[model samples]
Target: MSPTDLGPGGPATIGAAVAHHAAHIPDHPAIVCEGRTLTYQQLHRGANQAARALAAADARAGSRVAYLGVESEWYYELYVACARTGAVLVPINWRLTPPEIEHILRDSGAELLVASEDHLAALDGIRGDLPQLGAVVSLAGYESWRAGRDPADLPDTTDRQTPVVQLYTSGTTGLPKGVVLAQRSFFAVREALADAGLDWIDWQPDDVSLIGIPGFHVGGIWWASQGLVAGVTNVAMPFFDSSVAVGLIRGRGVTTMCVVPAMLRLILREPGVGKADFDQLRKVVYGGSPIASSLLTEAVEAMGASFAQIYGLTETGNTSICLPPADHQPGSPRLAAAGRPYPGFAAKIIDGDGGPVPPGTVGEVCLRTPARMLEYWGMPDATSATLVDGWIHTGDAGYLDEDGYLYICDRIKDMIIVAGEKIYPTEVENALIQHPAVAETAVVGVPDDRFGEAVHAFVALDPGAQATPRDLATFLKGRIATFKIPVRFTFLERIPRNPSGKILRRELRERFWTDRVRQVN
Candidate 1:
């Protein structure tokens, strides 16, 4: 299809977006990765040729094409190529164990894998277990493969509902599940923002965005696709390093980036970070975990940029709730809130009975958005359980205020019941992180005969800082209720977190509940 055939609604599909930009602004830089820059024309032609390469490897529409590597231009090219061929791109987390990687490949029934040379070793022993895998291609040989095919666009048979990307869950609670997302997941929010004239997140003509989050996660793909669709320059780092990211932001003149809270914290702590020029950095969008109030203030002062907080999951197509720049005042009460929903998005709190709760009542947060995921791949029961009647039951436990602001207390499964009193781990963790001696902390419920279940905390102290358990408990006297104070404190060099930097409370709870009959009290 020609670029004009995409219609005036704007490039609503991934393939259409790439093709449209190529026809209109062919010379504009599309991606800059590892000292190499690819313009829109190059990205478009490269994706077209890569789509032909997929066909040569026997991949067809609906086939799963797996990719194992760090973020790069090749990964993005394959992302658009999957769109062109109506195939599904499965991005495997590079940090996963070999068994975990094998599980996703086997479960997805991927026909072909394109991995970087660095990761070929991980797949060596497991290739025999994957009977459906037809062929494997190294990133080093990608150019030769692309050069063998014709640089032409494929037929645009795919539509908005066609699945293009399948991202696995972080597997914090259990084994990772494939989250199938359609083309609509990437463009719906942009269309909604345009119709509402909201700049909660915007892509300017001169914007240069940094792809800091890895491609295996939803946040990374969501942010990167935005820059491509808007026809702007995107600078990608294969992996995140505070020092390298700081240098790129200053040296490359990166204007905006999307990162988790942990990444922002590390960036601020980089040695000699103050010497870098951040004048061109315009916006810093962060999410993934709750940011301590002090860190938020510190980031605001350090970056001197507009800050936006997005709240969502892999199942919600990345972001349904956004805390815009205007609400980021120094002492505003809404600073703690998760912000209102997008123009076409809706959120409501529901109690145990699955009925709507009154304002300010903590309950499960459900969302109705145009960008929600299609379903958990091959899991009908799970699809039904999570997505019911056009609403997504986000497992997050939060409340809505009178003004419609979302206040996320914690994950529902992470809530601890202390003598029948509900205690959200985030509240205790947030309070603990405020202490001068604490660098990071995670709280869980441990079996206790007296209280049925008592708050147990795992902490990582700041370097050279010392504080006894009693000192911390005393520090929490007025901040939280006496019952909410942690009964046992275990200090560690660092807390275990998943690749996305989310605390793995399940791991901590495993130690305490190993001999118990049930996980809960």
Candidate 2:
């Protein structure tokens, strides 16, 4: 088959799509991970067996099945199995703290958890708190567990609108909110592109996709799902390693991939990366953070591939806006744009009052798309506050050019995104405040060369309590994820606050963000 001929028109649901591809391209590679490849037929049979295993574990329709592991072929099998069994797949970020992990399990009411061996200890730490959890299956034994079950296909229990994935986004309330996405979120954009006869994001028959991002995040899962729905081979990285990624591209003949700016930087820094043969790489789609113009220029020259930038939140089903390759002109003023909305998607800048602003105006960016999340799982208040009238109120400050290209200038929300992981300042502060030496603390994002942003904290200590950055970091070790801990702690007499007692984070962030074109790195 010709490359573009395999673009779209697959089954709408993920499970059905896998089955369709297995029947048509049984011997074609479906996934490649850690030097092992699973053909479409193998993937299909594996998912069928996994689905039977899930049923044996008592997972039913709408039951949440959590997976706490890195990117692997097993993750996809379990993910597809959940889709077939009508169970919601709740992918837990293994990097999170035990308390945070416990909260997700308890909140999602996950009946079963599939954990990697490395994370079994962490799971045990919070196992007592998750009363709803009925079974724990180790990734090391996944094969044995599935081998005893039937490999026959399960009955279709899901539709286009059935919720299949639940991704958690950090909340300002010092907790995480589950962003529930339906099956349509995976297929809507592709169907739209097919119907419109537009090839905004190209797919191919022989395309090999490298998924370097973690499967726990929306970007990684969305990228992998796109490749699967299009019947392309996907290379899944268990964990991202710069040198390993460069090797995979050349060895696997990767045709297209997606990554964040931070990852792109590391991949470029690999020894002899520039001289490497990347002629097989057709396109590189990057997002989840901003990119510097200089780096973009360097990447273009080195990789010799078309580059596209996507922008959206988990609530918008990962990407509602896309900056196509056509506008990646060297020295073009549109290089800084976040890109226009995808076909069948609409975007607008809205004032605080929810009124639409004129073009070239900066305001909160709102998006309306069929790919939008069904709701923030079980949080009616949050769902209503963010998803209003079929629009997602993305708390990002950006404007549209006269040509309709979106330029993200700042973040209206106080959320700090390190690399691509969302770190809420309130969550960090809540952890730091537990230290006896800490009187008050405020967290903010600082410009980082490697990561797009790093967490920085302004601290006011108790009188004569005595503490250093190291002391605070040590205290926060088990209380929060290492990345969420502050990289720099500025001792302050007091954290500056307004008369109403709200923190003036913008004031503290000024020293780092001053003179930058955008407040966000």
Candidate 3:
């Protein structure tokens, strides 16, 4: 894009980017979903109509418009439409329960809701309970709803600092918190990277990217934003399924995709994946949790795609620390690290007192980056506690090496203190999964009068495989330190996790602490 087309400050906003592409590449493919492809012209026209409809519904600059649906052309149109009208889009997690959905709608003060037919039904009884909601429209009849409206001119309303997305954190601890992300925090950093001429992995106009993760995640929207901003064709999968994903990559010639570690593991476990053609795939970016180096090794061997690991929180734009393609080789020590920060991002480890920790010492990971969120909506205390001196206090515990590779240990809250020894659950779970019969495992700290807190592991056995807790305990005896070994084992049909694929240790600890006043021992 030319400097004259960018939004007054130096970089273009998402709305500006889309407008530039529509004007220059009108015939180019933009979004493909459910067998229908929308060219840039179609996408822009639909977004124009949606923006006019929403504008008529009283949505203006800074107004909130919530959406409840799986990914589709309608979803993308509404997302861009919100940018055209300067309304903030809140993409709801369709996997969430009705009450949870209601909580987010209320919390975001969403004035209008655009939902799929099924999602609209999910809010049937609770629709009246929302006081700030001005209207709710169903995607099933979205075309008819906008029938009378003509394609309106793109409004010159939004700027880089406009809060375009308000992503609510998946509430594992309690109620989900809204993490407000502005265009500058989301796209300005990428603009900086381009200015620096760093193009290790970037969106090319010819790239056919895949949007597979649920749109509720920052990574999901952020991934799609890259494709949209760069004028690349994007294939939108309603949801990520291992089998369906392989087909999309092979059938559509997908060049890039962003996925979580669990999704990659599942795809590898899928039958015939070894024989599948991945010659067209250039990059597969995984994040939201640390990829077990063992799993990463297998993925690297199976798919020809270059693997990159991104580490960040919803509060920090999509990614600040990235393990680039060069560091993904098997046996590379950097594979276990979260790579160095991006060109414009900086990070450090801080002790409990907020002072810097020495290199190689584990502490709370803190990041100062252009992509950091504005604030946690309605959470002044949390915003204050998390954002200090322009640095985001990431709850994750990790250490930075001399070469600047950051190695993640575990969440500070999830760290188990047993008999004065600190035991990160992932360390124990990693050792447990090495057992042949162990399919999945989750480790959490449970109350114990003997050690103040005891480690308890929940294990899911492989199909048609059986192993007693004693057998697994014997197997783990020499693998990890005895102090780090789980004190108790409980068999489970499946391990519980949030949608983003992070294990819900709090859910596993609930049964053990049902009668206790506090969760902690």
Residues 263-382 of candidate 1 have per-residue lDDT tens digits of 787788888787346789999998766666777998999889999999888899989999999999999988888898999899999999999999999899999999999999998988
Writing each residue's lDDT as its tens digit, candidate 3 over 373-477 gives: 999999898899889989998878889999888887656657665533346677678779999999999989887654457899999999999998889888987
Better of 2 and 3 by TM-score: 2
TM-score of each: 0.80, 0.98, 0.79
Among all windows of ten consecutive residues in candidate 1, which has the lowest summed lDDT? 1-10
Cα deviation at 114, candidate 3, in Å, is 1.0
lDDT of 2 by residue, 339-408 (tens): 9988779999999898989999999999999999999989999999999999999999999988888999
Better of 2 and 3 by lDDT: 2
For model 2 the TM-score comes to 0.98
Error of 2 at 227 (Å): 0.7
Question: Which one is best on TM-score?
Answer: 2
- After superposition, the stretches of candidate 2 with alpha carbons farther than 4 Å from their true spots are 1-9
Q: What number of clashing residue pairs does each candidate have, in the order they appear?
A: 0, 0, 0
